[model samples]
Target: MNDPDFPRRIRDAGGRVTAARVAVLRCLAATEEPLTPDEVLERLAQTAGPVPDRVTIYRAIEWLAAHGLVRQLATVGRAARYEAVEDRETHAHFQCRGCGQTRCLPAPPPPLPPLPIGYVAERVELVIHGLCAACRAGERR
Candidate 1:
């Protein structure tokens, strides 16, 4: 999502684009998989200036998610991962149980078959979990 105009788009959506927000957005944009808040902070620290605290980062992530700039992945543990949404590409993720690795699967999301009559669909999320190739190979040993 190398849209140079992303900051402007965010501002147009009634959100402020701060340095911290931009850093976090950039970190997500550079990755293919969702990243937890801690991973985001570490990535931000490496690229951006000083790293923001956990609470601050979490708050920023929540705000960004609310504004549709990012989407949070459902987690089975303490930390939740997030990814940017501006790339116009939609796909599901597969979490490997054996290795704890999260991989982005290229399969298309299920069709939302139209509502009966007056109902409307807003958002949908589908996630699949299993052992990835590496994890399965390791298990065979």
Candidate 2:
């Protein structure tokens, strides 16, 4: 899904518009699930058109995440993952310890207690780890 707004977002975020940037944003926009850096590179290489190198994709991911266009999620003992924040609200992520499946969960309750003075909250991310439905079902069998 080539998104027109991706360009505007890049421009608005003071980022240079380039093919690699656009391609990376497009790749993120096309998926709802978070992607690892390696996965992103594999996806680009799998396409028919010319693909950016792994270094290029990695840089793009960093730039995009820094610009607030993408959200980065990292869980304990797991590689970092990223998801494009287009048309999606802030929320948590859940990963199944049994099957290693990850999915987005609803956001934590808003109006959270104030942070300590001098500490500014830029973003909040929570990770809930547990067995998923299928895994739970399988465990019972």
Candidate 3:
């Protein structure tokens, strides 16, 4: 919807707020799990008002990621996923191998291991892959 906080977040990140950007951010924030660009487009399409094109959605996601408003996740699949980077703590993710559904886990990110000389660590992302409850149940059936 029309939360003023979305635009405010965009402006605070030093980027000009646009409809596509606000819509994309809002969609991500509304969901507990991360979503691919295609998923974002689908959700936006289901909502009221005009929906941005694929290119516009991609550009908006790129801009949001560059400005730290969204975080591009490291995924196993070809399509990259993104999640809103709000005040949430650094946590791990659980990706269902069967359904490809990714959700945030409550565990904290592990500490970085020692690196070689002149090497710098940016961030750590841990994803545990397994069959979710539904998938596992289906396997038993």
Tens-digit lDDT string for candidate 2 (1-141):
566887888999898998888888888778767788888888888887889888888899999999888888866555678888876567878888886667877656456688899999876767788999999999999
Cα error, residue 52 of model 2, in Å, equals 1.1
Instruction: List TM-scores for all candidates, in order.
Output: 0.82, 0.79, 0.89
Lowest lDDT 10-residue stretch of candidate 3? 72-81
- In TM-score terms, candidate 1 sits at 0.82
The candidate that wins on lDDT is 3
Assess the local accuracy of residue 94 in candidate 3 as a C-alpha lDDT between 0 and 100. Answer: 89
Please write out the lDDT profile of model 3 over residues 40-86, one tens digit for every residue. Answer: 99999999999999999999999999999899887787588999997
Candidate 2: minimum summed lDDT over ten consecutive residues — where?
Answer: 104-113
Which of the predicted structures, 1 or 2, would earn the higher TM-score when compared with the native? 1
Model 1 spans > 4 angstroms off: 1-4, 87-89, 113-119
All candidates' lDDT scores?
Answer: 0.78, 0.82, 0.91
Candidate 1, residues 28-53, lDDT tens digits: the string is 87888889888888877776357778
